[model samples]
Target: MSYRQKQLVMQYAEINNVLDFRLKPELKEALNNIHKQLRKLDDDRERIYLEYSQKLA
Candidate 1:
């Protein structure tokens, strides 16, 4: 990579190490809850589709 690109990447890594932006417990829990809700919605969608398809057949 070019020198400027290398510098920018190194700067980003240093800032990330200092900040640790993705390591908050509340943020992680919120993400987990959203994931669970999405999974439930997907399951419900599949179940309803199957039920309707069976009825129409």
Candidate 2:
């Protein structure tokens, strides 16, 4: 898996970890922020790849 895939896997693990409600509110907010950033990263990666492939074509 690539770096972003690894990050997504780790994020999945983090989500599982939080499912038990063991984290504090601030920590939960931070995790949510991380989730948002990761999603944006994924979106940006897709856009970049599309642009790159078009350039190659």
Candidate 3:
């Protein structure tokens, strides 16, 4: 994942731990959005790696 994405993940984890079973609505929404971005970044990285490996083969 990208640097910003990594940071967001860390923040999300920290917030989750701190909030435990009581999370605010806005924070939950933000976490969901970050998760979406992280998924997209992961997909993009996988696609690029696949293309690179195919070129080598």
Q: Which candidate number would show the highest lDDT if scored against the true structure?
A: 3
Worst 10 residues of 2 by lDDT: 19-28
- Clash count, candidate 3: 0
Q: Which candidate is the best by TM-score?
A: 3
* C-alpha lDDT of residue 33 in model 1: 57
> What lDDT tens digits, residue by residue, belong to model 1 across residues 11-48?
54554455544665454555465556556666777899
Per-residue accuracy of model 3 over 1-57 as CA lDDT, tens digit each: 578777978887876775554546677777788789888888899999999999999
Which stretches of model 2 miss by more than 4 angstroms?
15-23
When sorted by TM-score, best at the front, the candidate numbers are: 3, 2, 1
Residue 19 C-alpha lDDT in model 1: 50
Q: Arrange candidates by lDDT, highest first: which order?
A: 3, 2, 1
Worst 10 residues of 1 by lDDT: 1-10
lDDT of 2 by residue, 5-57 (tens): 67876875776577556555666676777778778888888999999999999
Look at candidate 1 and tell me the lDDT of residue 51: 100
Q: What is the lDDT of residue 40 in candidate 1?
A: 67
What is the Cα-based lDDT of residue 24 in candidate 3?
63
TM-score of each: 0.59, 0.61, 0.72
Q: Candidate 2: global Cα-lDDT? A: 0.75
- Overall lDDT per candidate, in order of appearance: 0.60, 0.75, 0.80
